[model samples]
Target: MQLPTTDIAIQTDRLTRSFGSNVAVRELNLTVRSGEIFGLLGPNGAGKTTTIKMLTTMLPPSSGAATVAGHSILCDSIGVRKRIGYVSQMISADGALTGFENLLLFARIYNVPRRKRTQRIDETLAFMGLTEARDKLVCTYSGGMIRRLEIALSMLHRPEVLFLDEPTIGLDPAARLQVWKRLKELLETFGTTILLTTHDMEEAEELCDRIAIMKEGVIAAEGSAEELKQRAGTESMNQVFIHFAGEFSDSKPNFRDINRARRTAKRLG
Candidate 1:
């Protein structure tokens, strides 16, 4: 089935992934409308990261199919990659470099035209509110500042879709809100469709236009945050999350999961 490019930025048809016997994602059929913030809400190990990897072309799906920006993830991976920008949970900016230098590096890596590189970098910095700190070393930046710079790097290429995995993971509330503000402005200014994963209920409620709640590798509920709250008979997204995902079963994250999360937080903290 084909969708009009103007209407949909992402679509998946029973997309699945597995590592040996562990099915990280199972038969995920999802659609993200153009220029909207679509969130996948779940706990750790809920397959959100795996789904993102497949959509961003970093991990090939074990089965099923998907498309981004009107390009097939299976048949036209390069095309899918070209139209999207991704910010992973791990930090990507070089701390050794100044904010401006980091953007310049990404501009080159993304193959932005030399003539447009400086202009693109400047525009992205201003949009992300990083222009004043352009010459500051990334190591000297706050967690929020580094995250914004990472976001700016992703946008330097002017991608149509941006994928975020655990965006704002280790930031303080004020910083998280700041990032959310910039993301809202990004939609208004560039009309870039955003797909993000978060375990933070407040973050989802604050930033997402629509959300899919995942449990054991599948969507248990999906709708606007308000719609979900209504469905779950509550006003809080935290309650909505618990109503759908928490009551299911028991299995705490293992030591590996705990350690991985700590490392990510340490880096971004």
Candidate 2:
């Protein structure tokens, strides 16, 4: 189906980013519609996180352009930042502060009014099921609790666009499911535009309205998992992944071959 002609939460035009000698992301063009969940799926080192950073305005693009919530990444970074919330791969919180305190601090930073901050904090705490444990120091919170609080922190500002990088990266299956459920609830309740990166095919299938499969810093395929499976004449997303994986392997250097060549060059040196 064609994307709706409503507000676009994110749009990128040939977005590229590079380090000194290596390209991290290349010509990554994407659009995330308002009120939809968009998933960026790739294997490790496939530039999913790099592309996300650029889209979130955490990293400036080396070339091309992007806009978040209709604000340009280069020309209006602060405006983009105001309309977007980002959760990095690792949880960021003050271990010394209580869960409630941490959230209150963030509310202050986000410039939420003092009168409204308390109510918003309470709402988020209850929403994330952290109300009972709100007084406990972050150091005492469990992995699941910390993850929930991290998400709550990002959402406190009620941003139009939310970016989550590897949200369930190290969780148990039960915890992962709980997080997914909460994410669905949040989106349904608030109609927030979400962009997430994940290595788990099942997670993307379960949660994403659309999926983009990336490889070697560029999009390899895109569509719903079912759509991709149908196009590839397969019955499962795994089969589709396998088909694309084989194709990508043919174009990229073999890791083993590259390692052997490196050893030979070292010896010659």
TM-score for each candidate, following the candidate numbering: 0.95, 0.88
Best by lDDT: 1
Tens-digit lDDT string for candidate 2 (84-173): 888876558788999889999999889989999989999999998899988999888766777788899999999999999878766778
Poorest 10 consecutive residues by lDDT, candidate 2? 260-269
Which residue runs does candidate 1 get wrong by more than 4 Å? 1-5, 247-257
TM-score between model 2 and native:
0.88
Among these predictions, the greatest TM-score belongs to 1
Candidate 2 global CA lDDT score: 0.82
Pairs in steric clash, model 2: none
**Candidates' C-alpha lDDT:** 0.89, 0.82
